[model samples]
Target: LFAIAFALLRKYPTNEEEDFDRLIDNWSRREQPLFIERALPAVTPNNDEPPPDYHSEENLLVFNQAIADYLVTSGYTVSCKEFCREANISINDSADKKDQLEKKWTSVIRLQKKVMDLELKLQEALQEATVGGPTREKRSPGEWIPRPPEKFELRGHRDTVTHVVFHPTFDVIASASEDATIKIWDYESGEHERTLKGHTAPVQDIAFDHTGKWLLSCSADMSIRLWDFQTYQCIKTMHGHDHNVSSVTFTPSGDHIISSSRDKTIKIWEVSTTFCIKTLTGHREWVRMVRVYQDGTLIASASVDHTIRIWSLPSGECKSELRGHENVVECIAWANDSAGPYISEPIANGGTEVCSFLVLQVVCW
Candidate 1:
């Protein structure tokens, strides 16, 4: 039994008493002589000496001490009961106390292993952050950077300005205001150049065409008007929405204009004839804003319905709906870069928040 137990301990090399119990239970029912013959060489203490009678208490004590020494040198701690069990020796002790010590030592070994793993991970992180690695910028004590001063402000709008856009090819700015007008300004001189006045109600949005030749304006009067920006003359008026027209923008080619309305619809217009070519109708609440993708193949609209929907341009079919906003979705924009497309929502009371997603993926923020 001692020879078999020592052979099992040497083969498995574990500190747990369960391993010794399992091996004894498995081998004790087998033929004794054959087991002794197979286990004698494995449990032998030395090459030059004949095998000792391992069943003797003295021999068992010598073998157990050798195993205990090996375990200690290899950085393992085993209890007296476990060490004795590995040599098939019985011990008299309170079962509860033995179990408590075994559990405590097991927990200590587990915690030590966790600490070693954490130390290794911390060392790797420190190595990556040192020597000009791609880490966050570090600021020195008492050092600071100042913000640049504002250049100029264009101040002519009598009411809250809802939208402002820079001209595509000129040093001009177009701003729509609740004052029922779209104001043109010379940005370099910060001068209010002219105010285009035709809308009977507040002008909600204004967008310059791709060539900066025309400006599209939508208003609370339920109308979208195109203007010859250079002459400051109203070119044409397109009307189809039953409620306030909230926002408008020209498609990338400048051949069509897209407008969103409080009537929960998006209308596509032909720029040449001032005709409503198609109307998209999936939003359940007021459509707040609309924008065309750079390629003119897709259109995105946000609504008080708390969702943003992407629609195919010509077919006007709803492609995807993104939902997560707890309040109204106020605005949407394309980054036109590798960082991908994003939408912005204004909190009911004030601040602006932004959400980004991969183009056409339809994920919530």
Candidate 2:
């Protein structure tokens, strides 16, 4: 429920952003040689509004394995039809039962077989291609470069990693996974500092307000939760999103929150008052992303239907629609910020340039 004691970094001017970026970029992505690593047992779930029980996932896996072993030991090899018939299971054509269906089953055994066969064949193919075909530098068109990921990892989420976020002002990373908990990690130090468990459903989405003082989460359980990031406690549950709440965001002023849901509506709530200030209903499909401008004057919405729309804030007037992206516009970023004096100045060899220095000098004593 508490962050381990550490020094907080001071915010520097935009001109010094390069320095900060360099510091973080040069920060070793490699981990130190620490002694033993251990998986701490997570806290028991609270049933009050519990997310599904992922705690018993291991037990379920073990049971399945035991069942498979028993079947194998009894000299009953799984013929798809026999397996389903003996099990007295019926799967609709849409959701087929692996063993009974004509389609290749994506089972544990089948998956392992696929991996072994693919790897074996790929090795031979690579050898043949290398011996008789063109070299890497002399390859023909359509050759894969085999470049590795910029940043990829096997994140150890027992179930699903529902949400991932970087800290507003720190190198810290937070993720809420279907393990029915939230976890904070120091990606720089490769240290998992804390795991937060409270929500009972898969946390759909999460956001930090402008100041990063508070965190908000919406879950499939049709509830919006307010969490005090410092204390790591759920302080409030704003239960208005009737269906699965898909996304939640705090306004720039941190006084209000805008949330979108499978309920096909977006609700703006006054956080301090915990009251629904306005409900925006227009999208035919699920509204995926809702963002408020820094001035709190505009709200931008992106949906599954591939169009983006902007709405006037607080008043809930539909303002304008932005058309371009040809897919589900799940994300939007207002990256353009007015440059202050400290950010940068342009160089001019032949023509005049707007001087931020002059503007600052005129405004200052």
- Per-model TM-score, in order, reads 0.57, 0.50
Q: Where is the poorest 10-residue window by lDDT in model 2?
A: 1-10
Task: Give lDDT per model, in order.
Answer: 0.74, 0.61
Candidate 1, lDDT over the whole model: 0.74
- Model 2 error, position 31 (Å): 30
- Poorest 10 consecutive residues of model 1 by lDDT? 92-101
lDDT of 2 by residue, 1-365 (tens): 00000011122223323443344333223211110011123456787865555437554443333333332343333322243343343323213222321121225235445556886999978865654455557776555443344233536567888778877887777887767677778877777788777778888788887677788888888888888888888889888877888888888778899999887788999998888888998887887777776667777776776555667786797755544445566655553345332112111222212223224435542
Tens digits of per-residue lDDT for model 1 on 260-301? 999999999999999998999999999999988777888889
Residue runs of model 2 more than 4 Å from their true location after superposition: 1-154, 323-327, 339-365
lDDT of 2: 0.61
Off by over 4 Å in 1: 1-148, 340-365
